[model samples]
Target: MTQTYSTDWDIEKYRDDTEPEEHWELRKAFMEAHKGNFSEEYLVALARTFTNIEFMGCSYPAAVMRRIAELSKDVAKTYRENKKTKLQRTFVSASNAAENKIKKRQSDPGVLPAARN
Candidate 1:
């Protein structure tokens, strides 16, 4: 008699077992072997790989992970700066409108605050 197994279950087990497990070790070895002669392409690729592995809940060396985190933070800083510029422009426009309203009030002496009495 032959036993039948679910295709989905088999595929899931294959994926879990076949997924790359040596990414961090390989990356660490590469960096160590080429410490002083690191290239930009290598750094970018390493950082991207490290980031991906981290997102996948894999473990990596602290120092190497820190470097990758720093690069990621730099990217985040650039994004925040761009966002801040847009927000600043919006605030300036609003400030100008408020100033204009105050000027109009000041120029028209007929507009006055309610008396306390």
Candidate 2:
């Protein structure tokens, strides 16, 4: 029997096989290159990497992992709050623009109601 594998399935298998140290190094490099501004999903993935570390027998990795998780939580919270504020502002601006257009049309003389037929 032949089995078909999806891209997502292959990607997950590769990621699961990667070393914890390698994952940490890649995340560090990305944080440095991106100035700590990454997607919420990526940040959560980084936090999960701490749990997958091979050195579970050691305490240091656990400590560092806890710290990363906390930091990611904070960043995600702030990102969500900022996104909410931006959406609210956008909605208000759009509502105001629509109101102004209606007012303008009501004042224009060319758009008068036709007399009864």
Candidate 3:
């Protein structure tokens, strides 16, 4: 017998014990649980611990780790410069979109400018 399921977030998709669980990935859950909770420095530090590839030289592993840390720190530094909240991010995105739309209109030859009072 086939069962119908609704497209929803809260609904568990699987009922059969034999089915392999692939739909709900662990990485997605990890992202959801830790979204906007930690600073970038913390994340870079955490991520660096996970990547432990050894290089050719005696001090290669340490050098690789340091390089990884530097890259992660650079990425974190750019985004966390302002450290805007979720609401702030939303506002910034919306305002940027609106600004872009205005610019597009101004640049488009077919679109007429707004009437001045």
Which tens-of-lDDT digit does each residue in 1-117 have in candidate 3?
Answer: 544333233223222354234212322232233334445344333333422221111334777667544544543443345445424423468889888887887777775556411
In order, the Cα lDDT scores of the candidates are 0.49, 0.48, 0.41
Candidate 1 residue 73 C-alpha distance from true site, Å: 0.6
- Higher-scoring candidate on TM-score, 1 or 2: 1
Candidate maximizing lDDT: 1
For model 1, residues 1-117, the per-residue Cα lDDT tens digits are 544332221112212344465434344433443334445456436644653654355556898677766655543444346656663433458889888877887777675656211
lDDT of 2 by residue, 32-90 (tens): 33333445455445545533442242335667758665654543444346646763423
- State the lDDT at 53 in candidate 3: 26
- TM-score against truth, every candidate: 0.27, 0.21, 0.23
> What's the C-alpha lDDT at position 107 in model 3?
76
Model 2 spans with C-alpha error above 4 angstroms: 1-44, 47-89, 93-98, 114-117
